[model samples]
Target: MCSYGSKLVAPWTIASPISAKICRLRQVAKRFYNFGSKEYKSAFGDAPFFDSQGLRERTIQYIKNFDASIWHKDPIRTIVKGNYFIQGVESDTTNAIGNINGKQIFADKETFEKITAHISSSALRYEVSKCKDLMKAVRRLEADLL
Candidate 1:
C-alpha cells in the first residue's frame, strides 16, 4: 500500500529523486504508524501474528533513525491522506470482486444461508433472492451484521 502511494506521487513535474525518495519513506512511515505497531496489535489482537511490542518499537525506532532529509521534506500528511483514499478505493474494488465471486457461490438458495449467517437478517434472507444488485445484497448483509 505504501508502494502504491509512492507511485501515485510521481510525475509531479517538479518532483526530484530526493523528493520521490522522501515520498516513499513517508509512505513507509505512515504504514508503520497506521498498521504496523503495538497500537495496531492491541487494537486488533493476536492470531496469525505474534504479540511483540519490541517488534513494533523496533519499527518505530528504524523510522525515527532515518536521515533528517526524510522529515525535512515532510510529505507524511499528503501520503497519509493519499493512503486513506487508496484504502477506500481498494476496499471498494475488493467488495466488487467479492460480489463477482459471490454471484457464483450464491447461485443456489441453500448456499445463501451459509453466506448470510455472517451478514443477512431473516427479512433480508427472505428478500435477498429478489435483490438484483450487488450493492443491495451487500447492504442486506451489512444490515444483518449490524
Candidate 2:
C-alpha cells in the first residue's frame, strides 16, 4: 500500500519485470512507501511468479462477486496486499488498515478479533473483509515467506 497524501492506495502486483519496474517508479515518483521499498525489495521480488496459477485475477474476480453482506452488514473494503508486505517476516497478522463508517479505523489481527469478539462470525467476516485492501497487502507480505 502506498500513501498518497493521507489516503492509502494499493495496486495488485502482477508477476512481471515491467510491473516491478513500474512499482519501483511508483516508489520514487509518488513517494509510495511500501514494505518492498522499505526492505529493499521490489514488488516482483515479493511475488515472483505469483500469478502462475492465475490466482491473482481469479481472486480479484472472486472478490468482485463475493457478497459483502453475507459476511457482514457492511461491504468488504477490498484491500489487496502484494507479497512484499511480508518479506523476511515469519508470521505477522497484527497489522491492519482501513475504515469503518466515516471514521478511520486501524488495528492488528488480534486486536481486531478482540474488538469484534461479540459480533457474529458473518458480521466479523464482513468487517474483516471490509479491510480487503489491507488484508490483500498483508497476504502479499505473507507471500515473501513462501
Candidate 3:
C-alpha cells in the first residue's frame, strides 16, 4: 500500500470514480462475452419475419434476375394502400418506388419499368409499352402466387 496524504491505496484498488466505473463495465463485458461464447438463442428469437419460407423463396427468385453489380440487398420501408412492406434500393441509390405485401407487389407503371430495367441484360428483354397492361399482369401474377 502507498500513502497519498492520510489514505492508504492498495495496488489493485480503483483510485477514482471513473476507474471504478470502467472496472465494472469491463466485468460486465467479460460476462456478456463469455455468455455469448456458449450456445444461445437467436438475437431475434423466433420472429415471424424469419419464418416466411414461401415469401423467402419468391424474393430469392425475383432478385435472381437483378444485376448483382448494380444492386444490393438494402431494405427500404414502404407503405401502400395502408399496408407496409420492405422494398429495395435502386442502382442510383434511390428508394425503389415499390411495395410488396403478402400478395402482389405494386408500383406505378413508370417505377415498375424503371426498376425492372436493372435486370441483367442477358436475362432481360427490352419492351416499350404504350399501355398499363404489363404492370397489371405483373400485379395479377404476384397476387396469384400468394
Candidate 4:
C-alpha cells in the first residue's frame, strides 16, 4: 500500500495553473505601472489647483479610479482599503503582501490577507489622504498585488 505524507502540499504546487496565471497578471500590471503609457503619467502628474478643496476632490477621484482599474479584474486579490501602513497576505493564493513605509512586499496569500484586512479597516485611508501623496499611496497598494 502507498502512503502519503500528512502535511498538506503548498497551494502553489497544487494549483500551478492558477498561480502561474496570477503571476503573469501581476507582471503585466507592474510593467504597465513602471513604464506606463504617456496617458498614465499625464493623468497622475501634478496639477495646479483652483482651491485646496478642488485639489482634494481631484486627488480622491483619481485614487479611487486608479485603484478600481487595477483591482477590477480580481477584487478579492486586491487590497480595497486600509488605515495605518501594515503588511499581510492575499486571501486566494496565500501570497505574501504588504507596504512597508511605501515599499511593497508580496509574500504569501495567508500573510497578505491578514495584513490587507487589518490596514483596510484602519484609518490608513484618512491618513493617506491627508498626506495628499496619492501616487505613493496607490503604489503601496498596487505593489503588493503585483
Q: Which has the greatest lDDT?
A: 4
- Per-residue CA lDDT of candidate 3, range 1-146, in tens? 43345776643575686655666676677677745433453432343645589888889988887654433343333443334443433223333565331232345565555445533432234343576336444554444333
lDDT, ranked from best to worst:
4, 3, 2, 1
* Clash pairs (backbone) in predicted model 3: none
Q: Could you give the C-alpha RMSD of every candidate to the true structure, in order shown?
A: 20.6, 19.0, 18.6, 20.8
lDDT of 3 at 24: 67
Give the alpha carbon lDDT tens digit for every residue of 1-146 in model 2.
64445656553544565655676687787665556464545333445455546887898899989864443343223222221221121322222574323222244565445435533332433323453245554554445324
The TM-scores of all predictions, comma-separated, are: 0.23, 0.22, 0.24, 0.21
Higher-TM-score candidate among 2 and 3?
A: 3
lDDT of 1 by residue, 41-103 (tens): 554434475568988999899888866443323322212112211111111112344631111
Per-residue lDDT of candidate 4, residues 1-146 (tens digit): 11124554444454467755665666677767845577765657775656889889999998877743334244343343433322444332323564222223344666667666766665355336665457766676565434
Better of 2 and 4 by TM-score: 2
The C-alpha local distance difference test score for the whole of candidate 3 amounts to 0.48
Q: List candidate 1 segments past 4 Å from native.
A: 1-18, 21-28, 45-106, 122-146
- Arranged by TM-score, best first: 3, 1, 2, 4
TM-score of 3: 0.24
Runs with alpha carbons beyond 4 Å of true place in candidate 3: 1-13, 34-36, 41-75, 79-146
Off by over 4 Å in 2: 1-39, 42-48, 73-146
TM-score of 4: 0.21
Better of 1 and 3 by TM-score: 3
What's model 2's lDDT at 49?
50
